[model samples]
Target: MNQQSTLSSSDMPGFQLKALLLLGLGHLVTDLSQGGLPVLLPFIRESFGLTYAAAGAVLMTSNLTSSIVQPVFGYFSDRWGSSWLMPVGILTASLGFSSLGYAPGFWALLLAVFVSGLGVASFHPEGFKAARFFTGKRRATGISIFAVGGNVGIALGPLLAVAGYGWMGLKGTLVFLVPGLLVGIMLIISLGWLSEPQRAALAGISDGSRQGPRPLGKRWLPLLLLILAVTVRSLIHMGIVAFVPFYFVDVLKAGAGTAAKMVTVFLMCGAAGTLIGAPIADRLGHKRFFVGSMVFLLPVLWAFLAAQGMAAFVLLGLAGAVLVSSFSVTIVMAQHVLPDRLGMASGLMVGFAIGTGGIAATVLGSVADVWGVLRVLQITAALPVLGLILALAIPYPYKEAGQSEA
Candidate 1:
């Protein structure tokens, strides 16, 4: 075997960097496809006259599919290589997303979402795994970069879709497909020259959880704890992201545009968290970064509720950054558990985290329906403190009983 082919991520060549950039771009477009859809759900329901539960089902399908399928993909991508599968998923997502512009009726619309859901769901295992492959030194930096790209995508989804709708109405929105196409082309063009990372990449460890780390043991304690903490994290994250605009409009008596800007401010803050928090985690250790993010957020969330005018928006932005960095920190932790299973670790972090959030959204939505959005957020604000405890309790793999194996 050629010795140069054995380069570790720390020694990854410039070609690898280019490849990773491509992966980041591809995953970004893919995520945009998924995250962008929910913003359009109300529009779909209103246009078609669907029930809330039915509309929720349409919105939820991609997440459920994404949550369930990534592990299978992760298990395989570890063995098979992540590069090829991602491109195929990108193409599928592009086609599926494109169909939404012309979807005929209830059945066809659901069909479009379901089809795109699979495509969107399929990308994560491979993308995350590949990011792990590309980054060295605990993979936090790589995961952070990859995560930020996805966050940008998720954060951008609604904004871009709404803009697309404004310019071309339904037809203009299809322009969103252009990003997917560019990414897919870049990936397909890049594949043949780049051989797979050695089996060593997949040889390090495994996690029992579909959402947990990929260390070599059955112990899933830390990962499970983090997942729960993250569920708490998401409940607050999504509630604010999804409902705040409406809250701004209906509850605060603001215009739709001002409400939209408020949501944008929150998401931009989250993007900053993704980009900045990774390096912070790298320097601070996962526990401090994860737990501290939760603690810091409690007050900001309170301020968010009490705030008025621009003050409320600013508080939302600040709280959002602190709260959501947990998403990035958890990604780094996933890599730690699945030393060998970068793709699986990534799938767990990317796919499962978001999927878990979907379930949380349902519960939060019901809470909002019953208790009202303000109270739902107010109750959610403090839940992350429990996340703080769980993150503090996270049993590191080296701390676990099967310690030496990883």
Candidate 2:
């Protein structure tokens, strides 16, 4: 291990703003492809004559490859430094998703989505680990900045997809290739700077010199609880993103463009919520902020389901904001619980938990096929209550003196 690359408690910088923002930009580009997929479902379904279940299976494929398998990648990143994965992952994701425009059949579409998802999965764990090093002392806030990039990308995805479709039909997806290449090249140029300390930190953790004091109880127990909480949250998130456009078009008689805009509104509000909520979480306690966000989500989501006209959009925005506010908090808590396995900690929180919820999307799609979209929305509304209970069950991990609650 390079001596200068190693991160010790004494030498870590307070914050590396430029590098952090660059990572945020990379995150934005990577997730932008993912965001575009949900909005394109209606088009894909119309073109392919897919049923709701099949449409959802497409999402499941993306989620499963991009998310559920993240831990495996994280494990490798932990064991052997893999900063190069960042830029390579970005380019691969871009190429894979952009191929959607030219896919000739349903199987081809799945293959394209799978390729793109692999790129997504490859980026997150390493991206998050690097963000941790760049964040220095303000871990929660820095992570929020990184996470908000993805939220914004998701929010913008609909508009980009809509524009692409309007201009050049399905082929417009090729526009995604531009940002991905640009950012990938930028990250490639900065590889040496980002890799050194990040690799050293991984090395330090592997050798046990950098591990922090263990939390009071069995770490796995709270981690399991936290994963459960995030899983429920992911279920609600995937359900809304996957189904809301359909609900607007079929139930409310809204135009497809309007439906896409609504999804954008939901996600943009989520990005804003992340920005506003993270600092407060640092002050209020991660567990309290997390549990409270779920409490806020339940009523707001229920009201959105019952609402009509403009009120529905307002409530939907609130629901998105409240639900997403806890995202960075949960990741921070997971890292605190498993100090020795930072990469795996990030993967479980951002990957496995979210992917599990995405798997529920397929189930919800099956329900929609039988019961209808309204029923699916109702089921989604009820999920936050379960998440809240799980949040309450998670024991606050023991903090060192002067450390805030995990």
Which candidate number would show the highest lDDT if scored against the true structure? Answer: 2
lDDT of every predicted structure (CA atoms): 0.68, 0.86
Model 1 misses residue 154 by how many Å? 1.7
Name the candidate that leads on TM-score. Answer: 2
Across residues 1-406, which tens digit of lDDT does each residue of candidate 2 receive?
A: 3221223444345578888888889999999878899999989999999999999999999999999999988877766667888998899899998999899999999999999999999999989888877777777898999889889988888889899999988899999999999999999999998877765555556676654434445566888999999999999999899999999988888998999988998999999998889899989989999999988888898888888878988998988899898888899898777655667788999999999999988899999999999999999999888998999999886454544444
Give per-model CA RMSD.
Answer: 4.9, 2.8
Off by over 4 Å in 2: 1-8, 200-217, 399-406
Clash count, one per candidate:
7, 0
**Poorest 10 consecutive residues of model 1 by lDDT?**
1-10
Model 1 over residues 251-302: C-alpha lDDT tens digits? 6787655665676677768878877887778788777788788888888888
What C-alpha lDDT does candidate 1 achieve relative to the native structure? Answer: 0.68
- Candidate 1's TM-score reads 0.86
